[model samples]
Target chain A: MAHSEDVDHTSHGQSMGLLRVLGPAHVWALGVGIVLVGEYMGWNFAVGKGGAYAALIACWFAGVLYSCVAMIDSEVTSTVAAAGGQYTQAKHIIGPLMAFNVGLYLVFAYTMLEAGNAITLGFLVDTVAGMTGHEGGLDQRPFIVLAIMFLAWLNYRGVLATLTFNLVITAIAFSAIIVMFLATSPLLGAGEMLHKDLMSGQASLPYGWLGILAAMHFGLWYYLGIEGTTQAAEEVRSPARSLPFGTLAGIMTLLIAATLTWYVCSGLLPWEYLGDGVNGAVAPLFSAAQISGSNALVWLLGIGTLFATLASANGCINDASRAWFSMGRDHYLPAWFGAVHPVYRTPYRAIIFLVPIALIFALGAPLDQVITFSILSGLLGYTFMPINMIMFRKKWPLDTIKRGYEHPLHPLPAISLMALCSVTYFAVFLGYGTQLIAMIGFYIVVSLWFHFWRYRFVKRADQFTMPWPRPRGY
Target chain B: MMDTWNYIEYGAWALSALFGLLIVIDWIKIDTTYSEEALTSSREGELEAMTEKHRLEG
Candidate 1:
């Protein structure tokens, strides 16, 4: 008799599955962990683009984008119930080529974010070293590599421990925001904030309507990876109920966090200082704490930044590995990557593969540029959402199947997502037009390669993994 | 004469190398132990086969 170590009831050799033990809390943790890091740093870059006022406009506009995405994602993910999230959805809804592109988008988006997170960890350490009397500052290369490896190890062990750790750290990081809000006491309505000065001269409408358009690019930092919750759809115990509940809750939490973050930062610093180039503060929250002259606030926000960074990196490893593993299982990539760890029931190979790739991104790429690449990758994935939702509803009409959650305003969310994505695309184009076109061209070339070469390896009949009936009109 | 921060840097690099080695070792072990067929057979494939059967019967 073959012995088994994981999922006790399943035999050693037959069809082992990922552990299905996650709940709504784990889903929230996964999504929030991947995204909360943005609150600490990147969102302030919107201030760089559009000043304080335009950045606020981008924030709420992005909020609308988040709601639609959450709704559309929850519905499909709950009904489909698989890893690879959008990749799996596209495979079933569209065809293999679209699926291939979506899968690559998911992988790159998270991997880039993971790399950004690791670099931020190194920067945080260097800053701390200087603060603690080490003037020359420690090198960040090893710490960056170490962060990637450590998180990969956590992911390698098992999903349960990894996401549970995410839950604890994500909760603490989020509470730091809450604590900052309370400490700043902006609601006291005294001269605590420069709300009066918000509309002064160029600060409010510096670049005309174009500034608000430009800010939308960095606005994504506020809620970029919340959609990653669905990547863990396969592992959730009750994907139908838990997927929607956890995802909706995650988006709502981020919405509140983003608004408060904008208020706190913009209130404390002048628009110019908050979003400056040569002399700007990199860590906006820490800068705010410094301005406040509160030792307690400084320490809390500092630790919060560290925990949020680690949590984001850890969650990135988890989601990116799942997307890559899902592709491998389907033969879109090498089958060698499809293996799950027999003992840990994790995607060990994919986790290992991403370590060096993310390390290169961390050590080699510039910070703001790497983050923009991440946002663009995410946008590519989101651009597919409207098409995915529309086709999904067409293929499996509401009466045809049991859905965990049906989003109200069926085509409205889908249409809204498309419009917002178009505006954001133009926003990115205003700035990084060359890189944007290059990324799309790269995906197209890869998709062609898959169509001509890799499709033969995938068993056409076997690719339809969901047990649902044949799609309508097929 | 290496300084203190340099040693700390070297130590961190060593720990990272150790982790990488562990991962590579486990990776090679799994590749050698499991058959290509066994490793790639997933829950999704099983479900796909089930659907194929159901479609045939229907």
Candidate 2:
């Protein structure tokens, strides 16, 4: 069946806002912030004593899993290349109702992620204040709300501004990380770095190999928003060319930088000293701070962690807001979300809609549940996505588009990637019951509601109606 | 680059404002008119088709 015929290039500005500040390195740095910082924090929080060695390896493996996911998203983005990102791509492959449900689910997942990251920022600030023996107590809720507004305003400016903020914050965050590594280099030894005691059940996984994949849920969860960069492909300079390269470069740099930090931190800090209690989340970072014995490193790492996590939320807010704006323009969402800021050329109305929802999650929902749901939803999204790419290769049959810039081994590598993601998804579900239930329940409820609202209610012809009067200008 | 001010912290706030400005400028400055080449090609095709129509009618 035919979808909507006219593809209006009605975006904020035809010229990509990416050029205002970001270069390649800055973009790569932002990518690191988006993909790794949250993952690192999750590792430290959940894994406790074994975080450095066990958690580190698991996440590195997850990084490869994430890279494969990225590849699939890129292929789909290239073929359809809609401003709506995954939602629009899914609409073209499946149907309008299914796409609408998928879009709603994504919005929920991303909003949860924004809250989770903002909460992490609050945790960092509060943790550091406590460590310094500050008499005044800090609460995470107020700070989380404030952080959400700050990121929204930053994104409302435009793509360049968001990327620039990402770059600057990521640079400072990376600098602090590098300083910690350099400061602790002399004390690193083989025994401390490779220390793993299987009998203690501290650093080693109980389920052997499968436990590593299950633990990867936390590590890979941090790298969730890297695809948002590709989502902004139309707003980026040279979508067909630059966006793919940028995606690859960003993932690689982030993986290397984060892996190095984890390896170094694991070596310098002793396991017992690294963890305060079982499943203590803040231990690995605290371990580093203790080894440094400098209040400067402690505060710097704490602040850097705060900024890094906030940046991830900021990236998602910007990306998901744009996706909503695109949906509004295509009549999948209400007309209000389509309204661009006349002055800023940004989707202001969409940003306003997102803020309250994100705040609700920050105040009401649990962070770990949000993190797990985000991971599960991402895996589900990727699973549906590569099928679109495979469809395009067979149906559209463009040789260059099909074969170009994949993992050298072609469909086989992609298939392997899919296999890994499936394994990871099942392993994570078996490992954590509540998270699995939350994810499944969220998807099913949303999908069923959307089926009635989108298809049973709205006509197929009305799916692509323009929210605003068609402008005379292109 | 040595001894230069570290703009990392402040840069975050500043670039946000700057990118907003860039979007505004691009929207105002971009030429929205159809290109002459596109118009010319359409006119040529129309003229050729019109002449053929007249010959058929005659």
Candidate 3:
């Protein structure tokens, strides 16, 4: 039997790899930090497909789905306590093939989200400049490149610095949303925001129930990256305890923030206006602040939106790098990708390689396409969770491993999550047929390359061991 | 009717503000000492010892 002791650690040039310094607060920061921007933007597109009320229902459904998934994730992550998040958990339960695909899909999802943030940030800067009567706004390409580079550099510093920065910025971003909501409360009586003509607009729900299904993809934006926090399992101080506390807390925060944001934005602007193309999608909150004629609130919303973008991009880099690092460590990817910076003790190589790819995607794709692609990839990767949970229960039996937290409804929650993921995956496919096909083709090509080319290299290389210390007498 | 709806929106905003305040307070009260390098090294040592014992048993 190849025990963990026999596995090599020096292939990556780091002896102890990825210092464990994060606590529940840091985890909460990461959990909320990563998904904070979602509360700010990308969610209004749902208003386009399903009017405000339908979008709100979709948001509630997504919230319930996430709440269930978070509970199960807390249980699984606390037990596994690995860096790869779903990818690593899938590895222990499913085979290496599923792990490889899931890992790549996760990296793609995070990178695409990072790209989406960069693009959205560019739009926001342009919007602000346009509003202020500035000449031409900053060029999107150069701005996105610079932003991705800056975030990658911040991540390279260390996880502590990353989380600390995340905490401060996340607080500011959340404050901005609250301020927007409070400022917009008095303006709600002026417009028919609640009972708007839903079917009059071009982007109206033409396909009826199918349109609501399509809206589910955009609705998912409210809680899209909440699961990404589990990727910090390795760095956290006590994975079993802190992971659950942080994840649950983060979910609650997101739910409250999402509800407030949707309620305010929908009530402040007509659903038809909120659902229009790019400007329509992002203008609700800013327009709301403008309604109060408070320049300070407008500036706050602008600055807060920028910080929210930064937080999302920065957090995605952290997640994508760690997932890539784990794959490299396992020899599923090249050993070079697994290399940690000797000084920073961070996965510097993975972070560097991923930024250019994110920049390329950001420069090429529009916001809605980028968001749709990310949602599809993320949901595809999430499909593994329920299966993994069922397989784990059967493999280890409950009492075998030291469990940090347990889900209330054993297989039921896992089953429900699986059903939700499946339905959502199909919904995304039906809504984004061409884009989904393209993504599926990309996955197939990557999987084929992994099997033929990557598997050989991994077999040739010595097996890499888990870097974290395991419990005694395993 | 509009007044009722406006009050409800105001109530939601107030609740959101309360939640945000609590989160900020928790963040402020959190102990940063655990993340210090010295403490991290100490914990790593302890974990290393525990894992070494497991390796020996295996």
**Which candidate comes out best when scored by TM-score?**
1
Q: Which whole-number lDDT from 0 to 100 does residue A380 have in model 2?
A: 72
Q: Return the lDDT, model 2, position A257.
A: 60
Residue-level error in angstroms, candidate 1, position A359: 1.3
After TM-score superposition, the amount by which residue A433's alpha carbon in candidate 1 deviates from its true location, in angstroms, is 0.4
Whole-model alpha-carbon lDDT for candidate 2: 0.58
Query: Please, what is the whole-model Cα lDDT of each candidate in the order they appear?
Result: 0.86, 0.58, 0.74
* Candidate DockQ scores, in order: 0.36, 0.03, 0.02
Q: What local lDDT score does residue A372 receive in model 3, on the 0 to 100 scale?
A: 75
lDDT of 3 by residue, A1-474 (tens): 221311233232225467789999888888888898887777888888777766787798889889887887898888767678888787766777788999988898899999999888777755655665655444445456666766777787689899889888988988888877765565643333443444355434544776677778777888998898889988888888999999999999899888988877776667777766465656566665665577898788777778888988888999999999888777788765665554456776677778678978998877777777788888887777788878777766666676788878778888888888877877777778898888889889988898888888664323323333322333
Q: Which docking class does model 1 fall in?
A: acceptable
In angstroms and one decimal each, the interface RMSD of every candidate reads 4.1, 15.5, 15.6
Q: Order of all candidates by TM-score, from best down to worst?
A: 1, 3, 2
lDDT of 1 by residue, A1-474 (tens): 233332343455467668788999999999989999988888887888878888899999999998999999999998878888999999989888999999999999999999999989999888887787675668999989988988888888889999999999999889988888787865642337666676587677777787888889889988999999988887888788999999999999999999988988888888878877336968888788788777888998899899999999999999999989999988889987887877678888888888889999999999877877888999999999999999999999998877999999899999999999999999899899988999999988998899899899987776787778777898
| Residue A256, candidate 2: alpha-carbon lDDT | 64
Better of 2 and 3 by lDDT: 3
* Candidate 3 segments exceeding 4 Å error: A1-14, A186-208, A459-474, B1-58
Candidate with more favorable, higher TM-score: 1 or 3: 1
**Residue B19 CA displacement from its true place in model 2, Å:** 18
> In terms of lDDT, which candidate is strongest?
1
